[model samples]
Target: MNPVAIRDSYDVAIIGAGPAGLAAATLCAKGGLSTVLFDEQASVGGQIFRAIEETPVTDKRVLGASYWRGMDLTRAFRSSGAQYVPEATVWSLTPEREIGVSLHGGSVLTAARRVVICTGALERPFPIPGWTLPGVMSAGAAQILLKSAGLLPAGRTVLAGCGPLLWLIAWQYLNAGAQLSAILDTTPAGNRARALPHLLPFLFSGYFRDGMKLLRAVKREAPVIADITSLRAIGDDRVTHVEYRRGNGAAQRLAVDNLFLHQGVAPNVNLPMAVGIKHRWSDEQLCWVPVLDAYGNASIDGIAIAGDGAGIAGAEAAEWRGRLAAMAAARALGRSVPDPEETHVRDELARCLRGRPFLDALYRPARIFRQPSGDTVVCRCEETTASQIIDAIALGCPGPNQMKVFLRCGMGPCQGRLCGLTVTELIAEHRGLSPQEVGYYRLRPPVKPITVGELAALPKTDAALYAVTRM
Candidate 1:
């Protein structure tokens, strides 16, 4: 798609090309609205389905049938007649529905009648000892490497933490013939008993079958260690060994070089929060999510948030949400569009999410894993330790915003993406408040880091240039 040929204004602009954004853009364009899709990735598939079109993995069995489902969505999006701007980093959004995006060699401001944010979820904060070490990486990051480059960890790789993604990655590693030394399960022992009631609801959800396949595959190949408590990485320069204890037992050490860690995922609320949208704290999910109506409309009138950015329902539900949000947007704009099978879609969405309660309860990370203890580094970009955050709370820092002033915790290049949750939880635990009362980092544009050259090259005096935050 030609960037110069793209219009400065649209009937609707969708920020993100994941399943949610892709579905929304396709439907909105098909409804006779000029729709444009923007994404930082080189392709349409978001993190869950990275490199769908260009993946070198020929055998679909390696990635499973569910992973291949994104191909159909991307195919539909390609032929949906919507303008797609790949590698465009949307930084700022205004109440007037204008988006500030950095693309190609410079930045541009695009206006739309309505904006839909589907920027999706990010991995929950995994702040543990030696997390900032060189070889330490999130399980999602490791999967991205495998998906995009067909690469896997070379040396002995230890998979730790509790999540579906953790087990999925281990299965993928074994499928790809990579070395996996051990699988250290961090799931608390009582998790199964606690999640037992929710298990009945998920029995007919279709995910149970797939979940069993992954579980059996990983268990068959990998050395499994269950009921682990308190894990730590140890090394001089990089992670060389992992230490852990199990239920008041003596600490056991495992030799390792590569460590993959995961807890769970939370909504990526940075963009919506930057736009000054009202967010509510999710007590069950243990994170803050944008306040959205049934149709995915946010607190703002013309803005809608879909996908996991609204919550953590995973990818299938996000696709249904994308379609629902677009249908709502079409109706709001008075565009005559074919009605979706609302009842069927809603039922499928519910079915897709039926397993979440069980999963959330089963995999809730231990407090030490999420908040950590001692001087473990919490903020990778700023090298801010958990102790520094605790000290800030002791000094009555209140929340992440104030703690940012006391210590440069969330002000680094990541701009609080990595450490925001940890800091908020730390302060909340210290002050005896909830994550809601102790709010997250206050974000301002430019949300993504941009080059000075990009700013200098902006066409000044153009009335279309969106007003940036000034001192």
Candidate 2:
């Protein structure tokens, strides 16, 4: 939605209402910039604190303290006087800082002096045999249900993943009295040795005691099967069982009504990439991340990235980063920010990021999981399998974009969100090149799916219509 702010063009337009977006909006507005925050959610909190303002789960223990922290952040955003547009979907962002947004069957173009993307992360695709079955979904989707609707798995369910998010979800389900059949951890046993190099900083970091407590609580209540080497869902029409194998062990099956899969999260890069921001493959996070300066400025002028979209730092770090980025933007606009405020945000951001290397190394999914073979479905949007991608590589498919023309891997409704990483990795493995060499989809705007009827219905300026229709 084109927010009717005090000015037709905002000094800053923050695209998200998660921690980073909220904090950035607050800081920018208080520093005398006309700021606006847009989000697709009905409320202000992003996924990390989804439904913080309207959660049905009243018990704080169910969501934990970190989730509640969004309350204060949202309150500050509201008081900062930034125009908050909920249920607004920003479909396109240009290098010139122009925004094409849609809301409630209407669309408009808004301009901003600067744009900060806080569109966080997407759960890394976990491609396995039978994953496209109806009863299988990502762990992130299940968590959304819990947070937004106070819903829980009604029948036998298994959570298969190796990340702090998976463990946190398991602990929350236990607190909310949901039944769990098992927790399958896919972290290779050897990763502990790899993670040991970063263990000293982790011991002193804030994550140490809290992560241990949550892990122990979930282990006490649920059956945890660790060192999983391989996993797959099994069903005819819907997933009914999960088959997984541990190191040098026979495959075992568990009857399950639902399967929630995850490995880790990567930046939601579609918006950034569509606008021509430079990106590179991150070996640590196992995904593509935008190349950015220290204060969250991207390669593009007047655009910045914060939150997990910058990288896979946690919720608290995203908030601090929001402040830093917003303060930097404010300074660029000739506004004065207190020196102490900048120092405080930087210090806290550093503290939150202290143990991140350890987590990245420890929970790194095994190569077998990342580079699946055989009938495993890598691209769910198009139903493209691992063998299909491999065959494309064998037949002289150069990269992901070329495969899109032939195999239609990233040409679906998601526009490469679900399949981009897996396809890149598959090509990289088969071609004996780095993911960097394989590259990613060359995305352009309309970065999101929009109906022609909706666009035509909008009262558009001549320039707006020409911009969309022109080459």
Inter-residue clash pairs, candidate 2:
none
Candidate 2 residues lying further than 4 Å off, grouped into runs, are 1-7, 457-471
| Over 4 Å off, model 1 | 1-4, 461-471
lDDT of 1 at 113: 91
**Candidate 2: minimum summed lDDT over ten consecutive residues — where?**
1-10
| Native-to-model Cα distance after best TM-score fit, residue 24 in candidate 2, in Å | 0.5
Please write out the lDDT profile of model 2 over residues 73-160, one tens digit for every residue: 9898889988988888889998999898887767777889989999999899888888899999999899999999999998999999
lDDT of each: 0.87, 0.90
Candidate 2 Cα deviation (angstroms), residue 288 = 0.9
TM-score of each: 0.96, 0.96
* Candidate closest to the true structure, highest lDDT: 2
lDDT of 2 at 123: 93
Question: How much lDDT does candidate 2 score?
Answer: 0.90
Q: Write the per-residue lDDT of candidate 1 for residues 1-471, one digit (tens) a residue.
A: 225555779999999998899889989998989999999988879999898898877678787777899999999899989999988999889888878898775788889999999999999888888887878899999998888888879988999999888998898888888888999999888888888989988888888888998899899999999988888889889999999888889999998879989988999888899889999888778889998899899998899998999899889999999998998889888985675677777888889888889888888787777787688999888898888888777877888888878988899999998998888888888999988988889988788988888777655764445565332
